[model samples]
Structure formats: structure tokens, C-alpha cells
Target: MSLRTLSRNEVANHNTPEDCWCIIDHCAYDLTGFLDAHPGGCVVLAQSAGKDVTVDFFNLHRAEVLNKYRPQLIVGVLQGEKEEIIPTNLQDLSSVPYAEPLWLRARFCSPYYTQGHRKFQKAVRRFFAENVNPEAREKELDGTYISQKLLNKLAETNILAMRLGPGEHLYSRRLLGGVINGREFDYFHDLILTQEFSRSHTRGFQDGLMGGVCISLTAVKQWLRDDDLRERVMEEVLSGRKKMCLAISEAFAGSDVNGLRTIAQKTPDGQCYIVTGTKKWITNGMFSDYFVTACRTDKGISVLLIPRGHGVETKTIRTAYSTSAGTAYVEFSNVRVPMSHLLGEEDQGAKVIMSNFNHERFVMVCSTARWCIAVVEECLKWCNQRISFKKKLIEQPVLRQKLARMISLAESIQAWLESITLQMCKMDYEEQGKYLSGPIALLKAYSTTSATEVSSIATNIFGGRGLTETGMGRVIEMFNRTNKFDAILGGTEEILADLGVRQVMKVFPKSVL
Candidate 1:
């Protein structure tokens, strides 16, 4: 099936609705059957029938839109014109230096990644680049919840299941459009999901999409008893039927378990518990059906799975990030939940919370590292294209130094992230909880602090455009505005730094260096 070239006159002759055609970037598209399906309606297509719409199309549609609509709609190139647009292929890594991590560069090899990792990485990257990024700006600005259509799309690709960070749920499942077997998924694969998804560059919408589930669900799957209930909840969440979030921080308490005011009391019947508390700055709380919550029990700090009920209420909390995150302040008044919903044991929740934090911090590390890379990419592209004083920004020595620092930080953090993720792949759950906790905390602290520097340098390089929300510097601006999120969330920098030292001291030799 070879493609034939169509003459301008020949294209003009197919202007009728029965045989409509249009030109986009010198390529002829037979959209007669698709006119009715056009989101802007048939009249728009009919009006442009037989005319070159390269400018108009590029103005309204992303460069990738043609690739999305091409297979079925494109007919051929105009007789004497050449195709100017090339579709993005995720399998193809960026040739630009520092644009992608070392493993993605030419002739580079990673001890941790196999062909399976590469395949899954390509699939996930393509999925986000094509599906998520196109709508991210709108959702981020408008503070709209992720659409069900997108959720269904993610479900179809097994993204939701994969985000849970390798477990029995993925043992027998296919992933990333069947590019990789779930049985082969490792921490590297999990790292790929976090890094690639963050490429959307809309932090708030990224969290709203599924960030909560990625963290909260770990506690559920790892600690919850009652096999049937756990299975049911996992199925519902992974299938995009129900939403869940972690509720730990409160207005009065942050980074302090003892400071929490939320409390749950057991009923005399011993079948249920009554929960009363308020959680503030909770990610995805406004839209969650279940809260993987921490509270003070009669014995000690505990965790419970509290379903949304009559006494449960949530109000939106606007942060530096968009409300699309579903960030909320939640109130629970006498909410009754079955004792079976208790995670781990009655008073041993400190361990349960500790177990989840390792992976949570790891996830943050992966995202923050990639975010730094994105900032570097933005600055690099800008410096190359932006002119100052009749010369490109890249020609300036000071600008080069800024780029060098940003790239150095991004690359260093990525190396640390990969090393840590490799350990995660080899270690079992308890082992990771036991040994990796301190390293993860330290890595998170380092990466986030590095990100602050990266963000500052990037904003300086971007100048006024860096502060603006739209246009070329949008990503830099967003990073500058929200990079503090990584520094503050999961655990504050000072707290995590202190925790890392404390954990190290636990194993410190009697005779130290």
C-alpha cells in the first residue's frame, strides 16, 4: 500500500461533504467520514475543505494532533509539497545532551534496566505525551478533576495497576499496552512511571490524577487484613471506579505523629470504631471515597481505612498548586468504620506508617529528579532560541554557567535516584523498610534541596517569562512556583534531614571515624 500524491486541483475537487478533503502541513487528509466526528463540528472542516490549513491547524492543535488523527484520516502529501511534521516516537530518545537521563542516551547502558524496562518506558512516555499533556494545561488552570475518559484510558493501559509499585496485583497482568509483562515489573519500572508522568509538567493535575492512590494504596495492599475486602478495594481503585487518599497531616500537626488530634475509639460491640478528626492539606481528599488515615487509638497511633459517610465532609483547600489536586481539609465527626478496615494492628501503626514512607519518599525522589531535568530542558531550549542584545542567550558565558549548574544538579540527582531504585528492586518489603528508610529520606532531602537551586537558576535564566504562567516559560514558572512542594511534602526538609541522621545513628559503631 503505497501512498500517492494528490494535486492541488484534485484536492479542491473533493470539497463536497460526501467527499471532503483538507490539507495540513502539506499533507492531504480525506476527512469526509470524520467531519461529523470533528470536535469543532463539520462546518469548520467544510469551510477549510481543499485548502491548506497548516497555519490554522498548528495554531489550534498541538504538533502531535496530526499523529493522533493520521492513520485513519491522512491520504497523501500534496503533489509537489513535502511533509514537514514528523510524529514523536517515545522509543526514540532525545539526542540533545542532558535532555534525557544517561540510560536513554546513545550507546549508554544501565545495570538496572533491561529491554523490558525500555519497552515499558517507551509505552508510558508515549501514553502521557499523547494523552495527558494535551489536556494538562486546561485541567491545571481550571482546577477540574481528571475526566473519567482519561481514567478509563489509563485503566485500559494498566497504568493504575502499575502505579501501585509491583505486587501480586501485577503478577499476572499485562502492562503498558502489553509491551511488558507485569511479572517483570521492578522498582525501575515504578521509577519509570513516576518520572514519565511528571513530564506533563503540571504538578497539581499530576497529583489529582493519581498521586494519592500511588501512596495510599501501598498501605492498603501491604497491611490490610480481610482478604476479600482488600481485594475488592484494590480492584475498585485500580479499575478507576473509586478514588482514595492518605490523611495524616492536620492543621496543628505536620511531621509529628504524636501531635495529631484525630482520634478513633472502639465500639463496645467490638465490631466497629468511631472516628473524629480533621485533616488539612490532604492531597486528593476532596474526591476520595476512602481515606487511608492515621489517628490516635486508645493504645497508640493507628491507621484506619475510613469510608466516606454521613459525618465525613471535605472542603477544597487552595495551595500554590492548582485545586485540581483535589487538595482538601477534611472533617470526620463520629464516622463509624468496621474494625476490619484497620490496617496492620491496633496500636502498631507507627511501623505501618514507616513502611509506606520509604516508597512514598522514593516516588517523590523520582518525580523531583525528573522535574529538574524538565527545567534544564526548558532552559537549554530557551537559551538556544532566545536572543539578547542581537545574540542568542546561549552565547553568554554567565548563562552557560547557569545551565551547567542546573544540568549538573539534575544529572547528579538522577544518578542517586537510579542507585536507590536498584536497591529497591533487590530488597523485599521488610528489608526496604529496615535499611532503605534512611537513605530514601536523605535522597529525598538532597534531591528536593537541589531542585530549589535548579528552580532558582532556571527562573533566572528564563527572566520575566519565567514568572509568567503561559507561553514558553510556563514550565519554568510552574517549577519556580511549586518546586517547594517537593521540598515540603512527604516530609519537610529539616525533619527528613534529622530523621536520616537519627536512623544512621541507630547503627552507628561504638568507635566512630
Candidate 2:
């Protein structure tokens, strides 16, 4: 066979000659230099070196490598080849990387305990001060004031740490700082979760909390291994270097732990599992770096980390929220992941999943409660400023009564969340493992539904302006979107209510008997 020549697209995109042709089994193959950037390793590329290993490539490497790294590499044309089977794993190379700084890693990774030590607090405070201010008019139009502010904070934290070259330990510290220093980090967290950072901090709290769930999951998974995937993910998360989202919910399943339809069955070769199914209502579904997804495996339900691209198609769905962190309908048609990507044992995914849900639910409650507090504060501020017929809205007894009720509702949720958060802080994983599932469900249900009510009251108080996009109008929009999401994601209110019933049933029967 004559040596195939490289296509203009492939030749232009190759980083180096060593990375020129990724040969698979001596067919003189070229896969566009995706191996080096592969989170799994360069070995995946090495395995495919030298031949027309096309069949093996399609069966083994297509979904695994192409989907995740296609955006980064370029495949040159082969000599004497009639048709080039563009790898099934290829991604669109159209997306551009955000020009964020390297120091973001250090800020994100820095430990909370040490944030006050040395100049860390000062530096972080300065970072937030510089970035968290309300935006200029031009900036405000392009991005929402809240989102711009939060992004500024996120960018500042990410860029500074990255420039400082802080390691993973420090990066973790920064993540804690963002979580604990409510005043400084909470806004950004809210923005991150709700994908509405550009809209209103209070409204975006749910999205930020959702993002936190994925972040926490990444952290936990990192703790499970010391490999390159762990290192890369840690580096990305700590420095705010990479953006990712989770895919846990499916079309037919919504908090029904055992009803997942996505399957990760082992291939006949026993080398990998062919993951096939559609994941719906996935947060960050459209724009995530990789998906930490739950799929039914032969051993049970298992969580697998699948990179986006290739055959893993994503379709964005319009929702009440406009931020479009790109909630998507993801179809994994025969997507394959090696055994290494499996989180925990086969079929035992429920145990790992349950544990994660607890943290997720707790964070969601705390964040949503915070949003309610913010909404109440905003309403109070608005009431103070706007006067009707020579009197402030706060002066009206009816409005006062409504505000009081809103405040009370917010406080109730906050008190419960604080109590639960404190308990969470005290328990070891093993201890938490024992009691988290049920209470978490209850907390999520209570907080989200309560937040929705608070948002509605706040909107009513704002009247017509609440329906617009000016002043506190943004807050109303965010609150409305988050209110809907709160009852859905993590665990639905109905699901949690059912869980509460089950919990009560388990205990109440004994007393009655």
C-alpha cells in the first residue's frame, strides 16, 4: 500500500511531527494528536499507532477518544485511501478557550483554614474587591451585572492562583474559601450553579449549588485515585481552569434511584462497557468538559466519567432560565468507556450515588436558602426606595405583612440548613454515610419549595416591574427559574416527600405497634 498523504486540515493542525500520525496497528493511521491531551493517557494513542486499525479504532477508540478530544486535534488524510472514516470520537473544533489566567488554580485549591494565614486573605479579598463590583454600562449590556461580577470574582480567583503556581493543596484551600466566606464567595457560587451569574446572585444560587454538586463529585472522585485523570481534573477545578457539568438525570428517572435506564454493559471483549441511553435535564449538559454520569452496569448502577464529543450528541432545551449553561438531552449511542472510568464497583452505583446525593442536597438547601435571604433583602431595599402617593411600600401594612412572612419563611429554612450544615461538618464520611440519604431528601424538598414561595411573594411585591428586566426585575426572573429547578434537580420535592414518608413509616410503625 502506498503511504497515504496528510490532508490540509490534518497537516495544519498537528502540534509536532512525533504527534503527526497516530498509527493504530500499522495501517499508518492519523488520529489528529488527541492522545497527548487524553485524560486517560498517551497510552491510548500509543495503542493505535502505525496501521489501518480502522475497525478496532471505531469499535474501541471512536466514542472514547473522538468525542472528548476531537475539538483539540486534527487528522491528516491517508495516502491511497478512498474514504476517511472521520473518527466517531471527533468533536467540533469550533469552540474557543476562555483567556483566563493560570493563578485561578491556586485560588481555587487554597485551603480555607490557611486563607487567613500569610497574605492569602488579603490577596483574595483584593481579587474579589476588584472583580465583584457592579459592571459598567457597556459591560452590563453584554453580560448581566450579577454574572459579570461573579465571573470577575471567579476569573480573579482563578487567574491569580494560576499565576502564582499554587499546587493542588492550595487550590483545594481556595475552593473551601469560596464555600466558607459566604459574603465573598457566595455570589460567585450562586452564579456558577444557576448559570445566571450574569443575572442576579440570589436567583443563581440554585445553579451555583448544582455546580457545587459536580465540583464536590469531582473532589470525591479525585480522592479515590492518584492517577493523571485525578491530577488533571484537580488542576482544572482548583484553578478554575476548566468548565464541566454533571449528567445524572435521565428521561424516565427523576430521583428514583433504581429507575435509571442508561446502561453500561461489558463488551464481548470484556475490555470496556458499551454505554447507551439518553440523559435528560442534565445540568451543564450543553457546555461541560466531561460528564460524571450514572449508568446501569452488569454489576449494578455505576458512575462513569465520560468526556464529551464524538457520538455523544447534545441538544439544548429552552427553559425558564436564559443563562443556558446548556441543559441538554444527551444520547450515548454505544459510547464505550474502559473499566478504569467506572466509579465504585459494578451494580453498586446506588451506594456511591446515594452518598453523593446527600452532599448535593445539603448544598442545594443552603444555597437556595441564601437566595431567599438575598431576595428578601432586595425586596426590602426596593420597598425602601420606591414610594407611592407620598409613602414607601414598606409603610403599607399589607406589603409589610407580606415581607414579614417572606422573612420568616427564609429564616426557617436558613435555621434548618445551618443546623444540618453543622451536623455535616462534624460527621466523618462513614458517620455521614449512615444518616445522610433521608434527611438530605427532606432538606432539598423543604428548601427549594420554600424558596419558590419566597420568590413569588417578592415578585408580587414588585408588581409589573418584577416582570421586566430592570432594577430588581432580574432577581424576579432568577427566582422564578430557580424555584422551578429547586423542585426538580438533586431530588424532586415529591421524591423527597415520599422519602420522608418512607422514613416516617420505618419508625412510626414500631411506635404504633
Candidate 3:
């Protein structure tokens, strides 16, 4: 509905409980209907009726609160008042300093993003902001699974296919609803997807919705030998008709692959294998119809494609984050699978697993970097408007220092990620597996460790609200709870750091003094 301009005297006329009105930052809001629902009670609105409440509103609430309620409450802007143009365009940089990547800011330039990339980014961001974010928030709060309607939206828009990363399936496929063709997709596009989608502010539900498919499907597409079976699985998942997950970590093993106890024994006929094992902390396991499993074999460890059926069990594992992720403890009891389900050669589970690490760790880097930025955004927004000691919080030098440090860390990690992504775009899969693993691991380690510090300072800025589940610090609260996930998941910082050094040492120059 179009709003009409209202004069101050006109606003003053609606001054009773039956027709209450208040001006917030020069915008008139008809709160007559909301008086009884006001948390502060009717007297507060009654007393402020017919008066400008801009100062009083800022003193009590964050700007986002106004954004959240404006659509419903706003009636008109005061005559002669110029409304602030808060941007809704996905490509527009937030006028707030350090809120977006430097390249997105006005007067900045970059060789990395093309017109097509920009279009793709805008389309995906708009989709998430309008559709995914709202549902993600609801599902995260209620511990409900992602709706099939949402999945259908993702499928029809080719988002599900895009998450699998660039592959044969993308050939001739329309991506971002035709914003870009699938063949044009690269690491930059993948990076854009991860970063933009993280804006949903519902981290756990983000994983619950598509994280499993993103990580697990790569292993299937790259290693699985049966072309027919692989195609079938891919079609099912890309259509959003079936769910899949990677079953790797067991209670006895996390980073240590050799310590896994899951076992697969080949039949005497050599046509099948009986798989028995348990996987713990499996993302998306609770709802997956297919499990890409890791198991110990006669020669060594092996990878198998196990369809869910009899003797397969999954129980929800509650986490610091929400249960919407479908985190699970899974058990397999002598489940039979065709030998054709083997991924890559037998006893080569390590190789199969390694195939996914570069992409996985890179994705972790993208997520943590964006998540840190998100926390910084929350701090900046809160500090700018929050009143304390008769002054805005940002007026304090100490708070500015915190923001400076957080922005530096967030921007630095993003620069490193962009450099690495550029290399990923140029390198072949084999080359990435060979030379990029250590660097990717190190990037993840640094980004997530940086995230730890960012989350801490941001929470300090938000104070009690940072700890609260709702209101001004909602994003901060979620980040604080879930930020540690990146630090430990994929690969731990200590392990990745050591691995990076070890990898470089393998090719270190002997003559270097």
C-alpha cells in the first residue's frame, strides 16, 4: 500500500487509546491496534500518543526492531521529512562500514567478479532473503525439518544442483533461475553461494537444509564406479526427492580416519558386502535415504554406498546448535550392499575421503568468514544506536577498537579466501587434491580460529542481548553457540596447522638456510 504524507498536526489528532499514533524518526505509526499487544503495556503508547517518539524508541530498541515492525505499523512519513534509504538490493554494499566485502563498496573494483557473477549473486541473495531466511528462522526455533515446499523451490530453481558444485549435471542446466548458465559456474560461484546463503542468520537450519548434499554428493559423483547407479542417485537428490548424507565419523574416530571401527566384509561370491558399523554426529543422517559410508575392509578401509533399509537405524543427537540439522547417531547391522556400490578401489577409503577435503575445508572457510562478518554486523548495528552513559555506544573508543579488530580479521580472512578461490577456479581437481589441500586446511584453521575471537568480542559488545535468543542480539547469540563448529569440524585447527606444515615440508627446499 502506498503511504500518504502526514503533517505533525494531523498525527497529533490521533491521540487517544482508540486512535493512538506515534512518530518514530519522522514516520507516523498507527499503534491503536497494537496498544494491548505492546510488551511495555498500553500506558507507554498512551502517554506517547500524538508525540514524536524517535529519541525514546532508539533509547529502548535496535534499528532492526523498527525494520521488523515497520511494514505493519507504518502509516506515513511526516511532511517535508526525507526518509533514509536503507538498501534492500543484494548487490548494494551496506553503507555501514565493514559490513560487506571491499569489492562491493562504491568506488571499489575487482577482476574476480564478472557481470554474470554479480547477477548470479544478486539472484541467489534475493531468493534467500525473501524465502529461505523466514522459514529457516521458524524451523530453527521449532526443531522442525525443512519443508518440502522449500525443497521444491530449491529444486525448481536449480539451487539443489548448484550446491553439488560444478559438474556434468550442470551442463546445459539453468542456474539461479537463468541468471547464469551452469557451465559458467566455478569456485567463485560456489563461494558466492556459501557466503550469500549464510546471510539467512539461521546457521543450524542452513546445514540441515543442504549441507549434507553439498559435501556428500561430491564423493559420489567423483568416485562411485557404476555410472547408472551414480546417475540415479544424483537425479534423486538433485530433484530433492531423496536425501543423502556422509557417514564417516564414529564415536571412536573423528579426525583419525584409521581408528574407525565400521566394517564391511565381502561375500564369498564377491558380488556383495555385509556392512556393519555405527556413525556418530552425522549431519542430515536422521532423514537421509542413502548413506555414503566409510568402513574397514580386509585389505584396509573402504567406502561404500549403503541404501537405508533393514538393520539401519538413526537416532537424533542434540547439539549446541539446533536439531534442525538432523544430527544423528547411526547404526548398521549386517546390511547387504552390492559390490558395485564400492567407491573407488577397495581399501582406498582414505583416498575417497581425501577427494572431498579441499571442497569441504574451503566451504568451511567460506562459512566461518561470513559468520564472523555477520557477528561484526550485529555488533556494529547495536553499537551505533544503543545508548549508554548518555552517549551512543560507538562514541566509546574501546568499542571502536573492538570493531576495528573484528573488521580486520573478517576482511583478512575474506581476502585469503578469494585468493584461494581464484586458484581453485584455475586448477584441475587432481591438482587441487595434490597441492591445495594443505593451504585449504590452513585457511579453514585460520578463519575458524579468527571466528572464535570475533565471536567473543562481538558478544562482549552485545552484552546480555548477545546471550539472548531473540531481539537485537539474535544473530550474535546463534553465532556464539555455533561458531565453534567450524573450529572443530572438517578438521581441527591443530591438526590442519600441522598438516599444512607437514605438506609443505614434503616439498621443502633442502638448500634453504
Clashes of each: 0, 55, 0
- Worst 10-residue lDDT window for candidate 3 reads 84-93
Where's the lowest-lDDT run of ten residues in candidate 2? 94-103
Q: Which ten residues in a row are the worst by lDDT in model 1?
A: 55-64
Q: Write the per-residue lDDT of candidate 1 for residues 281-309, one digit (tens) a residue.
A: 99999999999999999889899999888
Error of 2 at 364 (Å): 1.3
- After superposition, which runs of candidate 3 have C-alpha atoms over 4 Å from their true positions? 1-20, 40-50, 62-64, 67-80, 85-93
> Which digits, one per residue and each the tens of the lDDT, describe model 2 over residues 1-513?
235465434533433436545533223444545556655577655554443445545432223344344334424344444554333211111111111111122433322223332234344334433443233222323422224345445644453223212234333444423533322332123222222222235433224322532434443353334377666665565445455566777878877757889988888888887889998877656656577788887656888877776679988765665433456789998887777766666677777677666655655665576577667766776676576767778889999998888888877876566556556555756566566567767877887778878888988987876676554456665676557776787777997878866865665656556
**Candidate 1 off by > 4 Å:** 1-92
RMSD of candidates 1 onward, in order: 6.6, 23.2, 2.3
TM-score of each model, in listed order: 0.84, 0.63, 0.94
Give the per-residue lDDT of model 3 (tens digit) for 272-330. 99999899999999999999999999989999989999989999999998889999999
Error of 2 at 419 (Å): 1.0
